[model samples]
Target: MQALVTVQHPAHVHFFRHAIGELEDRGHEVHVAALDKDVALSLLDAYDIDHTVLGTRSGSLVQVALSQATIEARLVQLARRLDPDVITAIGGLTAAHVGAALGIRSVVFTDTEHARLSNRLTFPFADEVWTPDCYWHDEGADHHRYPGFHELAYLHPDRFTPDPAVLERRGVDPDERFVVLRLTGWDAVHDIGDSGLDGLPGLVRQLESRGASVYVTAEGELPDALADRELTVEPSEIHHLLAYADLFVGESPTMATESAVLGTPAVYVHSQPLGYTDELADYGLLWGFHGDDRNARGAERALELLDAADTTDWDAHREQLLAAKVDTTDVVVERLLGDVGATGTARTATARADD
Candidate 1:
């Protein structure tokens, strides 16, 4: 089988990395096309996944449209040359477009219900759209609901084990209590009206006042006051760091879910409510807050969690979460390889014949 996997965000790389390797190990050919977003290319390089650069994101809607067109064209050309049996991506707008143009099957894995514009544009062209069972929105017949979050694709115990050496390499003492704070740039089309945590400097100061070491990871420019608190580590090593963290306070749902799945308690402060966030909170692995004063509430939750000594229960909670969810990587591999049924090639042929 020949497959093309597209990655637009750093998290997408993690979501698909193990699945791609499994496909290759099983004697299938996989090609990757990635956008130059954050640590995306770095991760593909670190994982030794060969790929071509699709494009980078733009700030404006008009520029984004142009960039999407350019990426779609390149993907189409690549698909024509590679003659892939299937194309897949996380929020795969380009793959959907290219696959439709080439009469190939495109499968999309997405979790964000708020990505209205991207979903509207990509769904019609996609052959299958898969989302976590906890996803809030419905996309009709073609949408397939799974029993797991995207982070489980890589962070599941079956696929990952946390390394304390990653902490040692970063000059962090494994015995010390530390908190990770992730700040995202609210610049995506879906994030136009959304807001993340406000007053990051104050938040860092508050965390420090509680005798916890704080590490900040920001997608946009950090406030000058909080610049010294920035976290620096290889992109591939982040999960390991997160796994050992005492707490995670962040605006990015992806990282929050990642931290929660790793057994670290996450306080997610964002304007929107995500299905996974609510579900993780239901399992006592995460806490979610919204509205204008969310930052303060999120900070308070972090402090409360930090003050608790019985955090060992987090592992038990995480075990429950793991038990309730499927290994997403296995699902992707099985679906792509047709272990359960027809492969994308068969679906593509049927679609072409219908036309």
Candidate 2:
């Protein structure tokens, strides 16, 4: 089948890379369009996924709207030329818009309930809206709940295995115990009111006092006091690093969930409550805190986890978490290909248009 997939973030690349490869292996023609967000383009390059460059994200919401319009115009032209059987993306606004204009099926996969504006814009136009079962909000009949998260699409044991070589290359000693801390820029619309950890210098000192090496990753500028603590690993290898960390303390829910799924304990310190993060915490793989005192609470939780003699139970907890979730990529690929006929064209297009 001919498919067009749009990627907007670095995480989206990881979420869809495996599925794209699987589709190609099954005799499908796949085209990728990506915005220059963080390491998104670099990842597509690293994975050898050929793609077209969409517009980059602007700093302000008004500029973002202008950029989106430009991107949609470009996508309409591209879709007309490609005439894909189906279009798919994570929170894909352009896919939904262009697919509607072209009378093609658009499949949107999302896990963030707090992406209020994006969801409202994309859900009505999408043919199918797939989300994790743990997602907090309902998007009426179009929403299809699955038994897994976006992270599981690539991080599942069936799809991924952590590499020790990555650790050695990062100059981390094999026997060293370390913590991974992530700080996000809070530049997204949903993050407008949210705040990350404060007093990083104090936190690092506390983490080090517990005898654990600290590795930090940040989205925005790091505070001068914590600049020296930044992690220098390749963007693609960050997950491998997370898998071996003793603890993950972060305000970025994506990395926290990634670490939790990798059998490392994560302390999520943001104001918003995410369904996936809450669910992971329910399974005892993560801890979540919010409100004014969240930073303090998160710090305490990090210290508590660090002070423990062993976190081996995290592996057991991870197993239980995995048992309850399906491989999200398999689900996505099946949904995308199941209705497409053997001729590599969507048989349901006309029927869907009629409906």
Give the top-scoring candidate (lDDT).
Answer: 1
Full-model lDDT, candidate 2: 0.86
Prediction 2 TM-score vs. true: 0.94
Please, what are the lDDT tens digits per residue for candidate 2 over residues 237-306? 9989999899999999999999999989999999898899999998888999999999889999899998
Model 2 spans > 4 angstroms off:
309-312, 339-355
lDDT of 1 by residue, 100-215 (tens): 99998888889999999999999999988878888887787677776788999999999999989989998888778899999998877889888878887888888888899999
Model 1 lowest lDDT segment of ten: 345-354
Candidate 2: which pairs clash? none
